[model samples]
Target: QGMVGGMKIPLVQRYEAGFRAGVAATNPNATVLVNYTGSFTDFALGKQVGQDLLLKNTDVLFAAAGVDGLGAIQAVKEAREAGKAVSVIGVDSDPSHLAPEAVLSAVVKHVDLVVYEAIREQRQGRFQGGNVSLGLKEGGMGLAPVRLDFPGKDEALRTVEALKARIISGELKVPTQPAPSGTAGANP
Candidate 1:
């Protein structure tokens, strides 16, 4: 895993860290490999990393490096074509449609909702300077519905939804990555 850019940048580490924490909370034995391509525009490196991870028996690859994530998606497609048991997890806007056969699901961050609420609060003269924490209960971040291409995803979705409910009800503790210090951005 490459930590190319500073982690303080909202888009750089927040989304990835959040997903990692979420996955860990659900699947404690799962191993998540993170690689930074320095810039979102670098697709080549992302592809290479994805391919390498596939070769190393990584079945699910999470692409969170913006445009670079597209390259990782391509690699997942190639691995699938080669009869490898590989799937991809997308970040930001849903990418399940990008490579339906390879995409299992996506992590969605509702940035627009946050912005709208903030704006509304300011307009109403009820703005607060302190931090505002938004999580699954607040409709801030969540996993997208599983892609139809993923086998048994319907059942998986049901299980995930149940877990989500538990987390919201405080019956289950959802792990969270520390928020980045700056304006929050959508994950992709």
Candidate 2:
């Protein structure tokens, strides 16, 4: 419930905020602590922050920095070695296999799909590049299938899948916003 101010909000912050919102929507009583490393490439600092959070009894963490996140993942692994029950939520790509025991899930962004759809529209002479907004309905983002080695993996995976279905069926609405630039947030 506390904010960790940094020089700027990074993509990791967006991922963190999104996940935190999701977690809170599902579990209103959950407490979330955010830690920020001023730089995205500073793995050492990221690791230090992650370790500190672990020491504070934080069990689940989401590493959103590109390479910096790797450092956080390393810290989570070390904590696990010491018999700590810690887990990580990955970003961008499917990293469930990177540390199966520690990575619970990943917020997957289907860039390939977005690119492909744009290309298709261009080829069909329907290229309206003003803006494009994609979400669960548009199959833009989702949670990756949980790793087989993760505890309660089946249930975890099922929950995300069911949520996806609900989203697609209009039973659940995944919140989204227009890209900061006005030229990149249009829905077809």
Candidate 3:
């Protein structure tokens, strides 16, 4: 499916780039491990991958793996039960209620608001099917409340706020995809 406004939505690459950027900013030497379950609903596979990642010293999981994310959650629960702490950031919905202890935050897309807007526009005869990019500035997307149980929560929030400000003002631009290394226009 293509956007009506011709905006190229780079989904996976954008998310992956954002993750890499954050990791580099916070811990330059951090090792990031990524995997796919091939099926979002494959609970067994997700949990298996989750466990494997833990074995490799993964402390945080950016789980956007659909229903497979639940499997990752299960792994986090098991680890916490054994006295190991881990973090999982969710996507699609606010899953903070699922596991308060392990969920750092979730990237939530406001489906309800989007639907309402579309309907309202239709009713007003102003409906135009097109791309709508929503973010913190548009009140149509946001992170779930950060659980303050973790150390440096305040500092982390402050950093996020600063980043948000820069993004909103266009002072910082998160590339939809990372530039290939050695490209003429790539960052040196």
Candidate 4:
């Protein structure tokens, strides 16, 4: 809903909100930093930005970039190789196999389900052209399998499940837009 390093997009805002929610759920004082990779296929730029962010003490780097995401994986791998503690969460399909040691998890977007639903709707005379929003509760998307090497893997799974339940039950309504300054009660 707003410009982030000239990459004005919705995904970054939503992902930041989700990360903020996680921080609130676990550590109230956690600091979350976001870096934007303007080019989707610029893996080298992604790697450079990722390494710079890691140098600044970012504990986790979530790369929602397209193919540039692979660059972030490389950055994490290099950092870990150099004996730094860091992890990354991939977007779209599961890319954990690309860097098993650095990838923590992935947000798997189910394009197939969305396509199927669209076809079904068309068949039933209910197709629409507007955007469709899918979240953890929707069969349209879910998290990929978590890597085994993550130290807090169990707690992370529990947290995700709890958040998913809250989201499904409408107890936790994630913000789709950037909130106004000075809002306190809501989690991101």
In order of appearance, the predictions have TM-scores of 0.75, 0.77, 0.83, 0.85
Candidate 1: list runs displaced more than 4 Å.
Answer: 1-27, 128-131, 149-151, 177-188
Q: Which candidate, 1 or 4, has the higher lDDT? A: 4
Candidate 2 ranges beyond 4 A from true positions: 1-7, 10-13, 148-153, 169-188
Candidate 4 displacement at residue 42 in angstroms: 1.3
Which residue pairs collide in model 2, if any?
131-186
lDDT tens digits by residue: candidate 1, 50-103: 787777677778787777788889899888888987888787678877788888
lDDT of 3 by residue, 97-125 (tens): 77878778877888888889899999999
Ranking by TM-score: 4, 3, 2, 1
Angstrom error at residue 111, model 1: 2.1
In Å, residue 184's CA in model 1 sits off its true spot by: 26
Q: Mind sharing the TM-score for model 4?
A: 0.85
- By descending lDDT, how would the candidates be arranged? 4, 1, 3, 2
Please give, for residues 1-188, the per-residue lDDT of candidate 4 as tens digits.
Answer: 11112143777667656655665566655555666767777888878877777887876777777767778778888888888878788877888888888887787889999999999999999998998987777777788887646677788789888888887888888766544332211453
In model 3, which regions exceed 4 Å deviation? 1-10, 178-188
lDDT of residue 39 for candidate 4: 75
Model 2 error, position 168 (Å): 3.4
Local error of candidate 1 at residue 120 (angstroms): 2.3
The all-Cα superposition gives candidate 2 an RMSD in Å to the true structure of 6.6
Q: What does each candidate score in C-alpha RMSD?
A: 6.4, 6.6, 6.3, 3.7
Supply the global lDDT for candidate 3. 0.66
Q: Model 2: which ten-residue window has the lowest total lDDT?
A: 178-187
Compared with the true structure, what per-residue lDDT tens digits does model 2 show for residues 54-93? 8777778777766667778778888888898888877779
